[model samples]
Target chain A: MRDASEPGALPTPGGPRVRLLDADSAPLLVRDHFAGGDPGPIVASLAQVPELVGPTLPFLGAVLGPSWIPLREKEIVILRTSAVMGCRYCTDTHTVVALDSGLGRDEVRALRGDLPVAGAFSDAYERALISWCDAVAFGIESDIRPARAALDADDARVVELTLLVATTVMLNRYATALGLPVSVDARARLAEEAL
Target chain B: MTALATALADESLGGRVWFYTNYHCNLTCSYCLTESGPKVARRELDRATVLDLAREAKDLGFSQIGITGGEPFLVTDLPELLAELAGVLPVLVLTNGTLFQRALLDRIAPLGDADVSLQISLDHPDPVANDVMRGPENFRKVVEAVPALLALGIAVRIATTLEDGDADDLPRLCILHRSLGVGDEDHVVRPILRRGRAETGDMGVRARYLDLPPELTITADGAFWSPFAPTVRGGSLDTDLLLSRTVRPLQRPVDAMITVLSGRPEGADSTLNIR
Candidate 1:
């Protein structure tokens, strides 16, 4: 039985169900994308959507790839959404991605769902963005309108951020269901970055 | 070296290419990932770009194609686009399954052979839950479209996303699918992605990252790493995850995501939902 940290491992007792796609036989594109690396269970389970993969792939790209939202703004919403949704893979991955994007160590902590009081967040827009995402993440529909207002609806970035939040939230459930495991190296890297 | 590096070095392409047929949908489902609905802005790759991606996928040895969007059928020239795409690779269109009425189906009926299929969404067996899951009257159209589409020689499959309390509804939903002529095997049950309206309004929907699916996407925007990303919001070049501006070659960000996604197989469980 592979441990919980290992991809393709058996599900721990009482965990959400999981299924794997055969790595050797996955479509050539998927195999190549993982660089013939461990194709993880998430990749395996996508066999569940073979027919829909083509259609659904681009939405992921549009939201995760590039859009009207700026990188910093996008990350803030994503990190906040990840926290609300309890998606570990997103929180960890975005932390590294945020650090790579030049966020300070403390700011990264703020993104991990910590209190903003540690001087972790410096940008006013980011602060407002966090509040809005927090509202959105917890399913406070009415609160979202005000949060959206505070973030500035007139600015195009806010609109894009709304989309980003929506997209990440969807992915949060899918990723959580698929069980994206984190790497030991990634853990070490994120720890170092936070330091 | 990580698996992502190894995967990138192989230089293969087009196993399964996802094209955003368009970025608008007829319905505004609360949990939509793209925020697609009638009122949303329309963003679609032009005909030339679709053809360009098809050429790239064909040359790269892509196996098949998946066409997705607000509603793939909403593209003004869906039939023409499907014909062109199916000409290059086998194509499947993921839809709410509400668009194909008698007239629209007649226009594109020729491509219904092995080249195409439809994966339609239905939430619960009851019209009320499903209607609420989708929007106003979504359930009836999609449910009714299934047998009609199957009659057109088009393969039909049921795709459902179950929330926390929604699993008990699955067996019944599968039964409902059978009543509509779809078998249990033809029904695919999945978890709701905490997106769009779902994220803001769904307290029951759970979320965590899945290992990056080894899939590539193309559109007017650019080549992307994976659809299951946190999304870079900008004009295009400003984002780190844009794998390429054109289909020519992938940039480095693809490698970055794959490395993280390929890590820790043992951690692949829904319990990773960190509080």
Candidate 2:
């Protein structure tokens, strides 16, 4: 079994420090690394290193809001992209959120193509979104071009933000590949809950 | 089968239905299947039309209904619409978590009484990574909204997208979920859809199949489906009923129904036994 306390532990030049939190049930030793002294400088220095698989919630909020895209489409794109990328972490995490967003077992299942396309997404717009997701996943940029072309001036800005949202899948895949531990809260939730 | 046959069979069994409120979405993901958002509105389903459809679905025996869109929250009267639907059938609203407002929550919170659930999507557990994917600021917004939903005593779940090497990264994602205040008791993990960008080249479909259990079903859209046919077009009356029957029987004592529903054929040992 893996050591839960040292989930993503790394040995630095000075000593050992926990890098990522493990999902397993184990007590986290927060003060162990800083016990020797105040490691403010070290912590600050670590912050300089860009996180490969970081979070995107803040960015999403600022760019997209009430007037443009709804939460459902945003999440559907995220989850669909993650699914296309084949990132389990992204898939699992988004599945929970998708549920909270009001997708039930059937709709969630339908998201994976369980239901017929004719009945799955009720509108052409949604079908277009799903198609665009496929184009990006398959490296078919041209597919999204039409959708981009169809946008009006204001909606076009939202489309730009959508591109950024799509990019997250790339980062998510990279982070998962590198073996960074999930955050503490995510681990606890997965352990006790279904996600 | 023809579309009509599919619809008839679908209607006979009374399965779940989805309503896309609009083609607009807040984010533009690279691998989106529908090319949703920005400039696509050929068929926008307004709340009234959706309610009419919902009533039809209920009459047809559908127990669950989903409200989807570029962002359902973007619809001005979404909470009211959800409220209306709650009176008839259980409703699930899919969202990105950026548009969850207090007023909406206040209106919809009471509707969770055995007939409603909210699903939020947060791609990456790490702030930087999530922000980078969703834009430069989404990470904070989603994180902030999570606590708000939880505070309402509303059930919240996080949906993370899975890519080729995500299984190895599961540990980190779990940690991230907890850090974001989502507990294991509160969420479920789901696989990413494979029909999009991930399908380009030989995106390692074999690797994705490795972690999945035997008998796991994968959708044509590339999501891990449980007990159902591989494609939505492949669904039939018999298939739907079979899925409903086999799902519960196939689940392990500790397995979640949703997990089973999201099962895929990737990564399963051929010889392993499934209930």
Candidate 3:
């Protein structure tokens, strides 16, 4: 299991203090940044939870590897989707990875809702994806009829991809609610590599 | 914009158009709505078909057109598509910032000359939270991408989804945005849409506050307005969907909110209402 403070971990500024779960009886740190109230129950519940990182990380790695989707495209969707969901922590992390994946500065800016279509994406495809993101993030009921019909063999993969993206959004909310801070050193390392 | 405005206000009479390119993406987040992947089928809309749809949208008087799927950038000829659409009406594209290249940037740079805007998603204000949502290293990637786009002279806006209990975090996010060079005037903060995996998650402290009505009336353009204000333009559709079988004359702001919140039947009841 990964401890709260690893060798290269960077302390989150103004973020929550993370206490690694060592034993079953260890007290959990439940208070989160987004959740306004008590953190006792939340932290206790998560504390000492076994095998917390493996399943999620490996599953995500397998599903998002080169065989599943291009590294660049996957990163772009993840970064933008996280942004839309208001998961700032996720957005910051994904943005760095996106740059490392070969996306340029202009492309990153566009992900923040700049030009109607991103430079690398098709206009029609961009419209469909953005609308879907908005619909899901905003809780708006969307008629995906156009998106469905527009999908061809090449685009059918989106169905699975959408589930992955949605899952990440869920995780972001959960993590933030629990008051987990960004692994500072890791984020910095990524930024350095990407640049 | 008028067509979008009209459709958002009235759900019954317009046509909906969707364009899918591919499912390939650069990041691997825990929750993805499309379940996108690289090996999956590559069903995509060709250039000619997209052009045809644009013409159809104009003919139908359907004011809204949406494009989506995995990462649309995996397609090779995106610049051409944008150039063609530039001649048509308004178009909006949703994207993650990973696939953007300088060549493509040059090709689509002209879109600003036409009426086109891009809506990017940034879930959290903090770098760690944002990266955790996508995958390791994604936070830095998106951060770097922002300044690059700004350098191109593109107008960028940040959209943050405010989950229940996340309201207070807005100021924190705003501060983060400012640090990244995003002005308060240019960013957009929104509430989280409780659907998909979100419905199954913690419901948070605010979840109990969401008072869901029944039935929602969404216009063709995708706006959920109040159904009680004599018009369904900005009203909630939940109240209308559950209370009335027909499109009731929107009369009050409160009534419209009831309708809009309840418009999407699935998971609406589970949403955390935090005022």
The local distance difference test score of each candidate is 0.63, 0.50, 0.50
lDDT, candidate 1, B13-124, per-residue tens: 2256777767678897766656677866567877776776677656645567777776878888988888887788888777898887888888777766758777788888
Measured with C-alpha atoms, the lDDT of residue A129 in candidate 3 is 61
lDDT of 1 by residue, A120-145 (tens): 77666677778888887776889888
Top candidate, metric DockQ: 1
lDDT head-to-head 1 vs 2, winner:
1
- Cα lDDT of model 3 by residue, A134-194, tens digit: 5555554454554445544255576656765676677568656655555564478557655
Every model's DockQ, to 2 decimals? Answer: 0.02, 0.01, 0.01
TM-score of 2: 0.40
Residue B185 displacement in candidate 3 (angstroms) = 5.7
Cα lDDT tens digits for candidate 2, B1-275? 63323433543222455565654566755434334455544235567766765676566445667666556777777778887887878877777788666776677676656466777777676778666545566677788887887777666677666555656766787787787678777555554443223333223232222233312221112112222222111111111111221121222111222233234233334231210
**TM-scores for all predictions:** 0.51, 0.40, 0.40
- The deviation in Å at residue B104 for candidate 1 is 0.8
lDDT of 2: 0.50
